[model samples]
Every structure is written in C-alpha cells, then in structure tokens.
Target: MSDDDGLMLNFAIPDNGTTTTANTQSKNVKVRGGRWKDRRILKLELEGRPKEKKVKGPNSIPIDASRKRRMEEKPSKPKSSQSNPTSEFKRAKFTETKGEHGGKNDSYVSSLFTNNTASTQEVPEESKEETKTYLPSNAPDKNATSFAGLGINEKLSKHLTDHQRFKYPTKIQKLVIPNLLVTERDLFVKAQTGSGKTMAFILPIFHKLMMEYKHKIGRESGLFAIILTPTRELANQIYSVLENLNRCYPFLVPGIVIGGEKKKSEKARLRKGVNILVATPGRLADHLENTKTLDISQLRYLVLDEGDKLVELGFEETISKITKIIDDNSKIDETKDKWQGLPTRRINILCSATLQNNVKQLGNIILNNPEMISVDREVEGTILFDDDTTGEVQTNNEHESFAPDQLIQSVLIVPPKLRLVTLDASLVNIANKIEQSGESSRSIVFFSCSDSVNYHFDVFTRDGKKFKKVKDEETGETKTILVSPDDSADEDQDDAELTSPIINKNTIIYKLHGSLSQQTRTTILQQFIKDDPKFPHKVLFCTDVASRGLDLPNISNVIEYDAPFTIDDHLHRIGRSARVGAKGNATLFLLPGLEEGYIDAKLKIVHPREENLRVTKYETILSSAFGEKNSTTKNKFDKLGNWDIHATTWHLEVERWLLENSSALAKASHAFTSHIRAYATHLSQERNFFNVKLLHLGHLAKSFGLRETPKNLGKKSSKNNDKFEELENGGKKYKKEDPRKKMLRLAKLAVNSTSEYNY
Candidate 1:
C-alpha cells in the first residue's frame, strides 16, 4: 500500500444511533498518514464520543415512560460548528479594582524626575495698590527744620550740614537726640532698624563732649563715655561715626578696641587717651581687667548699642562683669567733679531694634529708672516725642519686628530644583536695572551658612580670571596683578575672586561670613562701601553677618536666599536696605509646599502692610533671566523657547562646572549637607512651616549641583570602623553610634557658631 493509504482501519456506526452534528462532521474529515510521533492527539481528542450499546431485551435496563417526557420538556443548548471545546473563553478585559493594596503608595519618586516642561500654574496678579510699596512721603515736614531743632550743637550741626550731609534728622534721631542731650535720666530707645539709632546716641555724646572741650577739657582729662557693642563690626562702625563727628573737634578723640585687633596698638592709643571709647563686650571686658591704662573711674556715659544682640550672643555675663567693674571704678564723687553739663552720675542708654524678653532682661541689668522711648505704631511715618508715652508698649512681639515701611518685600515660592536658576535670574534683573539707571547700586544676598555663601561665590565667579593687589615701587601706588592658579596659593585665591561674575558681568561680587578672617571681613566691608564708578552693581553674598548693625549705604536691594531661623532674623536681614526712609527692595526665597504657609502664619505679622509685600512667580523670574541671545547657545540665531530651557540649560552649566572642578564639587556637597543640617535648626514655633521632615532631599541637592541621591550623598564609608576595633581575637566589633547623640552634636555646632554675631 502507498504511504497515504496506510491508515485503512475504519469503524462502522449502527443505523439506529442518532448522528450528532459533531460526529457527522468528524466522519467526513480525513487525517493524513504519518509516523506515530507525528500523529495529532489533540485533533483526535476534539472528536465527540459515541453512545454505549445497550444489552439485549430483559438483560438490559428498562426505560421509564417519564424519561421521554423529561427529555422532550428540556430546552436544548445551541451548538456552533466553529466552536472548539478545549479552548477557554476570553478573560474579561482587565479592570483594575479600585482601592486595592491600601490604594496607591505615597512617594517622592516624582521629585527625582526632571520636569522638562516648566508648566506652572499662572499666579494671580495682585492689584497695584495691594502690591505697591509706598515710600514715606518726601513732602517737607514743617517740623524737620534742621539738626539744631533736635537739640544738636550749632557747630556740630553746621559741620553735619556741610560735610556729613545731614539735611534733616530722621524720626528716631528726632525722638532720641533731644532726650539724650537734655536729660540725665537713663533711656531705653526702641525703634525700627536702619532708623538712625546709631546717630541718635552718638550725636548727644558728641554734643556733650564738644561742649566740654570748650572748657579746655582734653583727651588726657578722662574717659567721658564708653559704648559697648555685640560685634567688632558694629563697634568699628560706631567708632567711625564718632570720628566723622570728631572732624569738627579733633581734640575729642575716639578709640575702638574690638576683637581681631592688635592689643598693643589699642593700648598705645588708650595711653594717649580717648574722650569716647567704643569696644565689643568681650574685648572691653578684657581691657577693663588687663589694661591698667584704660580708666573708667571718670566714665560719665554707658551706652549699650545693639543691646538685644549683646544679650543674644551670650554676652550678658561678660557685659554684667564690665558694668560691675565700671560701677566700682566710677566713684560718685569723681563723676560729679570731672565734667559739668553732663550727667552727675553715669547715664545708661540701651538701644535696641526689638524689645523681646531677653532685651527687657538686658535693660533691667544695665538701665536704672529708664524712660521707654519708641516710635508710635499708630502714627504712620511719624515719631512721637510725647513724654506721656511711658513704660514698655504692651504690643505683640511679632508687631514689634515689623520691617521698615519703605522696604518693598516680596516672597518667591520656588521649587528646590529651581532655586539656583531663580536666584541668578533675580540678580540679573537687578543688574539690568542698575545698567539702565546709570547709577551705582548695591545689593546683598543672605544665605543660611558660610559654606553656602562660599559655594555660590565660586559659582558666580568661575568664568573670570583672578587678580591680586601689588604695590608699585616707583609711584608707590597699589595696583592689582593678574593671578593665575599656577602662580597663586589656595589661600590667596579668594582675595581676587570677588571681582568676577558669570551672569552679572559688570557687577562686582563679594562673599562675607563668620568663617572669613576678621581683617578680610573688614577689608571686604570697606571695599563694598567704597563705590567704584566703573562697576555699577555690587552684590555681597553673606550670612546673617551682614544683616545686623553694620550700616552699608545705598543698598538698593536685599535678597534673603535662605529663610531666616527666626522672624526677628527675617526682619533684620531685610533691614540692611531702606535705611532712614530710603526706598529699597527685599525678596525672600521660600520653598513651596509647607513653607508657603510662612507668608500668612509668620511674615504677615512682621509685614502687616499688604502693599509692602507680594508673591513673586518663579516662572516669570526664570524667563526674564535669559537675554535675547542665550549665552549657553553659540548660535545667535538659535533662540531659547521657554522657561524650561532657561532653567535646564543654566543648571546643566552649573553641574558641568562642578564636574570640571573637584574643589567646587566638594564645596557644593559640603554646602548641601550643611544646609540640611541647618534647616533642622529652625525655632520650635516655626517647625510647622519649616519642618525638615517634609523636605524633598533629592530635589534640594539639585540646587547645589549635586546629582547623587540624598541617601548616598549623606552616607559616609565605614573607613573608621577598623580604627574602633580592638586588637584581641581578630578585633571586637564596635556598636553603632546613637542617632540622637549625632543630632545633638550637630545642634551644638549650630548654636556655638559665630554666624549670629557677624551679621
């Protein structure tokens, strides 16, 4: 037989059996002959089975009559010829059940992904009246006739008008100068920062000393006044003010003895004698104890400038010691005999911007039978010299910390990843304004830590070459020499780095913080104050070090790049500008989400006037940051499209710069870690708004040009584990350090830092 004819076996069906449709179809279907392995079992399995044959007659089972009736009554199921019995019905299209597995997991994974589309919801525009920060009217005050009207000496007032440019006394000066010049009673002076508090107390002392000099009183006579401050900067500033006043009367000498100065020089000057002395608490205490030439037995005035800060710096004990020593040295009999027209006994004047509990406590220690003098809040843009206003004003402490009315304060609700670019944009805007105005302008940027200030200073100055100061042999003129990395040591680099900028090309950049040497800090402050007509814009990146008592003139803007530790800090940071009613702007950069609540919960109290504050959109700032031609793009014709391009390109440039320089990368990492640690140090009351636990660590790292995950970035290798191991028995393993102890150590570092005093 042929291969096709090999399967010849056939089965016959009886005629009586009913032919089902499946069986009939199978009967007609043919199978090809093949080897046993190739035969299809599945195909055979599809065929329907035949019914079994019944046994003959009585031997087989009898059929019941009801069986036919039941079979006839049952409805038959329709069978389709194309249906396969072995195949499963299609599964119901997958439908996700709602709320399964405790709903979707909450995650911060989205923060890790870069949002290429900078699609931000449009922030509502505030009304002109609501957003506007109105400057105090320049309209002539009928009462502000001259400094002489405020009880200033005629010669001193004339000199001030001619040289010092005292057109008119400020509100604080109007209130304080007259009281100090006329009364021998102790005074507690409280007013807004930048409201002429320094001049207030200084002028009265100058007037009294100038009056005494006419009686042939010289520096050799005795020390008539001693001014104590919290920081060396403030003390030096007060001394300078005294010197300026002294230009009229050179016989009345002023001397400063602050930290970071040569004791020998201070001693030598003291031996020559000074009519008025200005010194920091710690240094003054040392001088009183160690320097015998420093005589306070004839001291007539004890003026504590920035008294609140003096107490805040934990100098209360030192100040107490100094005050007690002064009391013991100054005999009532000697003070009465030394000078006429001045107080019979030493008059105590405590000047502070805010009257918090600590300040009150400080006042109790230094001030006796004190008269409380403060600007009345009810009278807008006016100072009340009404003698009836006595005792401490019973008001909210929050209200007491209000910013100056002329300061245009705004808040930017920015994301962590966008902070760097947004800051650059804001600075560019300020620079552009300076360029358009054709006038010299100064600005300050406040950071949370010194490391952050250093990192940002490097980032901004990376594009320019550095130069160092050199003295010319023939002309004897000091000039700068181009300093290259190969020729320069690491320590000398920062001195020349301030002259460069990556974005604000014409703007000079300066970095200041507590970490800088005292001399370096003093030099930078002097340079910032000295206006070089060549550079129109000057920006200083500093910590709270620049926020306090140092009066930097003509500061047009202040940028609080980091949220302050307290509301008082926030007020003080902005107080650097808008001095004595000058128009100025301030911006606070706040991360979005929980931090946004600060605007209403805390900031409103410090800035009650709605017109002085507005919410600035980060998108607007980012878009305006780039010019007509994107600097990153080489092609002039290739224009940038949107905010996303500006942010991404700028951040990428920063990251690239960090990658190329290992030192900068290390600084950035250090700044990132320090920032996180500092963020946790906010006051307990402010924890609701600035909770570190709510922060997105990965996103914040991007601000510092860091790409590593937070876990990896903060994790240190176990390199010291071997050092802790014992030598016996292959070394016993040391237990892990307690996290609570680690946290306490970091807190101690923050508290002990000099950041608060410097600013």
Candidate 2:
C-alpha cells in the first residue's frame, strides 16, 4: 500500500510458502477500523501502489492477536438483498461516503491549499467581535455614530459632520448632550479653552433646532437661542463655531452681532430667521433699539460665556436690557392678553473661569437655580501637565518663591526723588540675576500710578541713551569748510548695528484706556493680535484695561509699574502672566517714601509748645538787650553750637523727661502727670489728637496717677494693653526689626533727627 491510499492494516498472513503463479492477480484491500484514540491520525493518508507478490507464511506484522482472533471468528459477510448486485455495487462505489476520518474532508483540504482566502475567513469574525465590545453599550458604535448619538438629530448631525467632526464626542459633550436633550434645565459648565465647550452647547442646541425644523413647531416667529459673550472677539469666535456647525446641518442658521463688524450683514442674517444668535450685549442692544420688529419671544436657551467678564466690562446693564427685550413675558402687562406663542420656560446657561458676587447675582436673576461647575483648580493641573512636556514639573522657586516651604521677603527704602533711578537700577540688577542664575526671564515692576509709568519709561529710555547718537562740528574759516562729524556717531551706529533687532519689530504699540473710540480701540486691539507674519509679540501699555477677558497668546512677562490697590487686582494682574501653561515674571518698583503712605505718619514734635515758648521767651529777652534788633542777634535760635541753649533745652525738656517716665510704673505716677500734660499740650500745638477733650485730659491725668494698681485703669488702658500684647507677639514672630514698621519708623526718625539750623 502507498501513503496516498487511505488504508491501514494489522493482520497475520502466510509468508514462507513459495509459489509461482502463471496468472498474477492484484488484490484490493479494504480496512474497517474503530475510532482511533488520537483523532489527528485520521487526517493522514498513504499514496503509491504496493508490490505484487505471492508468499505463504505467518505475517511478521504485530497485531492484537486476541482482537484479530475475535475479528476472524466474527460472522461472514451477509448475502446481498438486491438481485442486481452488480448495479448496487456500481452505485455504492460512485456515491460519496464518509471516509475513515468520520466527516467530510473537502473544507479542510481546500483551506490548506488556498492563498489569502483562508486568512480572510478567520479575520472578520475576531474583528467584528472586538469592534462590538469596544463600543459603549448604552450608545451606538462610536465610529458609525452620528451627531444624533450626541443628542443631535440627523439634520444637525449632517451639519456637524460636514464640518469634519467625525469622531467620538469630547468629554464635555458626553456630560452636556444628555442634559440638553432631556430637559430645559439650566447648565453651568466650566472647561478650559480649546476643551470644546463651545461645541458642547452648540451641538445640543442644534439638536433642538433640528427638532423644531422637522416638526414645524416652536417657530414662535422669533429667535430660538441667544449666546452672549464678553467681547466682540469671543463673540465672533463663537459665531464661527456655530456657522461651521450650521453649514454641516442645513436646519441651523446662526448670526453674529457684535461691535466693530459690519452691521448690515448681521442684521440681514438675523432678519432671515436665524435659529441661533451669538452677540455682544452692546451691539445687540443697538440692533434691538433700531429694529422694532426684532422678535425674540421664542428665545429658549440663553448662553453667557465668560460671565465674569460680562459683568466686569460693565455689560450687566446692557445684558439685562437685551434679556428683557427677548423675555417678553417679563415685560407684558398682567391685564393684557398673552402673546399667541412665547416660551414660558427658558433655559439660561452661564460660563466663566471665575464667578464673582455680581456674576452670582446675575446668575440668580437670569438662571433658574443653575448648577455651578468650577474647573479652576482642575484646569491648573491640566495646564501644569501641558507645560511639563518632559514629564518633570518645573519649580519657579529660584526666581520667585512660589513654594510655600521657602519664602524670603525684602524691604527697600529709597528717597522719593531717587525712586525712578532706584527702579531702573533694580530692573537691571534683576535682569543680571536672571542671566547669572540661568533662570527664566520673568520679572515685573509695579508702579503706584500712571504718572510713574511715564516716568519709568522716560528713565529707561534715557538710560539707554549711551546707545544713541551725538554730533560735533569744527570751527569754520572764512571760506567754505567741510567738517567731519565726531567718530562717536559711527561708534553708536556700529553699536546699534551690533545689537540684536527687536524680536517683535513690526509689533504695534497701543495704549488701552476707556476714553479711546470703540472703532480705534478695536483696530488697535486687532492689530495687537492680528497674527501678522512680520510681527509676533504685541506690546500693550494699558491701564487695567487688559486685566480681564483679553486672551493673548505667548505672553511671557507682566510688568506692573504700579502696585494694585487691592489683593484681588494684584492677583488679576499677575494672572496675565503664567497663563495657559506659560511661565511669567512680575516686578514691583517701590520707592522708600512711597511705603510711608501705607503707614500712619507719626508726630514730629514731642514738645512743640514748650520748645516754642522757650524760644519766644529767649527772643523777647534778646530783643530787650539789643536795641537795634541786630539781625544776627535777633533770636540766636539759628547757628546754635552743640552746647547752645536750644539744644540744651530740648535735651533737658524732652529727652530727659521721656527717659524718666519710660517705665510703665513711673509713667503711671503723679510725678509723670505734669510731663504727660506738657506732652499733650505740645501734641495739641499743630492739631488736637482725636479732638482730646478736657474730660479726656482729666482721665489721662488720673491714668498717670494710678501707679499701685496696673489693672485699675479704664477700658481704654485694657484695649491698649491687648493691642500691645498682640504687637509684641507679632513682633517676635518677625525678625528683631519689623522691616515694614522699621521703614516707617526710620522715615520718622530721619525727620526728627534733622535740625532747624540745618534747614
């Protein structure tokens, strides 16, 4: 038997008997076997013919003898039932039957011999199962899902997808879609910029628009949705987002109405029955004023983006007006008949990075028990991670100690006249420090007023004058003479040539104030952020105008020429720096005398009346002696030597008295009463301290007399004692010298230590 033939035999036959047959016959062998223990063996086959010979002997092939004997002893083949045996045999031979392998082998044989067809069959099953499991069970397959999956119907889905947004919904979309779909509940969502917050609201409103379009309901002859933004720039941005979405979905048409843009086009679009309107309150209010038939009674959803800024920009009044215009129900008289179609229940949504008290109040009036979502801290983490691309958080401790563990505060005292000079020197020194330390170039200088800003600008420019030019001319003769200019000009030109050109050479410098025309302001601002190829950094010198709602990219430094009056303003100013994951620097310029303004000025003369009285009496005596009233001898108060009468009098009358009454007990004794009265009299010389009354003076007299009992003093003493204790404790916590108080005391000391003779 050959390997190709499907046969296996285990038998014993005679092998030793030799016979030469004249006629040789080939016998066909058929084996009938039970199922094998190893099923894999059934697939094997044998091919090629076996040798044809006759031999008589016991076969040497090993077999189970008992099984073979049993098989041999089994009954012989049964007689055929059909009379035409040959016909039956032919039919049986031709007909297909199960081979020894037990099942049809066609499929297995074909798979083994085929090319890529085998792989194709196996791949789709696993892929299909994987894809099925990957999709969220509650929603349809994300890949095949339309905007409908995001709560937007087919009409909106077409528009949104047409805008090339063919993917899974963003995180904000996932949270907002269902809420907007199910109810008109007010939503407050706080997400970072570029987190797709605009789409979150747009898509849901799109769904509502499509619903209204399809059902031919809720038309109400008015706009359906109104989106209020803080700035014209932001309003335009939101308009663009909706416009793209509207293009994708034919049912939606959004119009933008903001300041510093073409009004006619926007008005025309709005008149054409816009489903959504994105606008700034000021401009939209203007439009509503002119167009009496501008109906918004159907306004269903109101979105206020950057809600904090809207209030900060003084838009609350305008916003209220616009909302009142749209909310006809609020305006209608109770006695009058109700409008034919107006939405009674409107949804108000407000979004902002920060929520202030005014914003909260606005929300209370506009939104109905709205939910508040705060992403400030969470977004900070995202920003930090974004800034740390190398996966290592950078510490800003070396320059400005943001770390709580290590803090160092310094106090600098400079004369008022030298303030500008000191500030210039300090900036240069700080710049040097940054360079030497290889730290980031982040620093800011805070000025107290706009005048100081101009002063510093002038000082800095003057300091940079060594890099400027100068010219010199030689004396000329009678005839025409050509004189060469000084080499200094060439040197300055060379230095200027060597110096690096300003990084933002084409940057437009603009001043932002409330007085600028809206058009001029818009043009300046647009130029500042114009994204021109030639310029990148737009330097803006503003007076708190750019503190809020102005989102500029790549701002590395914030210079506060003046310190903010309040801590909140300080936070807002520094906030302009270190925004959107960028490192920033802030510098504060404080002059010596400037700090004294924050502190109460102390009394200069401790015994002004007594001192003046003594001087007056001396002048009287001098006048009596000198009949001529000599100018030099008029007072002798001036040009007083170290041992002069005035000096001696001041020492004995003021310093010595204060020293004797320095102790608390001594100060409370009867002996010190006269000194207290005299000091009080002196203090009263310039102006009465706290309008001290005779009764108050008597009380002071009694306080001075109570030496034995320290606690016997009235409530005033107790309050003083408590304050003293607090000061003492606070002083101990600080260094031996309280830098702030020391600076103030030093200023007072400087004034007191000066002499009238010197003046």
Return the top candidate by lDDT. Answer: 1
**Residue range 7-124, candidate 2, lDDT tens digits:** 6644332243544232332233233343342222322221123322332212122346555667679987555534222111111111112333211231111110111111111011
| lDDT value for model 1 | 0.72
What number of clashing residue pairs does each candidate have, in the order they appear? 5, 30
Candidate 1 lDDT tens digits, 129-244: 54455655221233676888777878999998899756788776777788888888888888778877888888888888778743656788778899988777777788888889
Candidate 2: stretches off by over 4 Å: 1-178, 190-203, 206-222, 240-251, 258-269, 312-318, 329-344, 376-508, 531-536, 564-759
Instruction: State each model's CA lDDT, in order.
Output: 0.72, 0.42
lDDT of 2: 0.42
The CA lDDT at 489 in model 1 is 63
Give the C-alpha miss distance for residue 433 in model 1, angstroms: 1.7
What's the CA error at residue 46 for candidate 2, in Å?
A: 99
TM-score of each candidate? 0.77, 0.40
Best by TM-score: 1
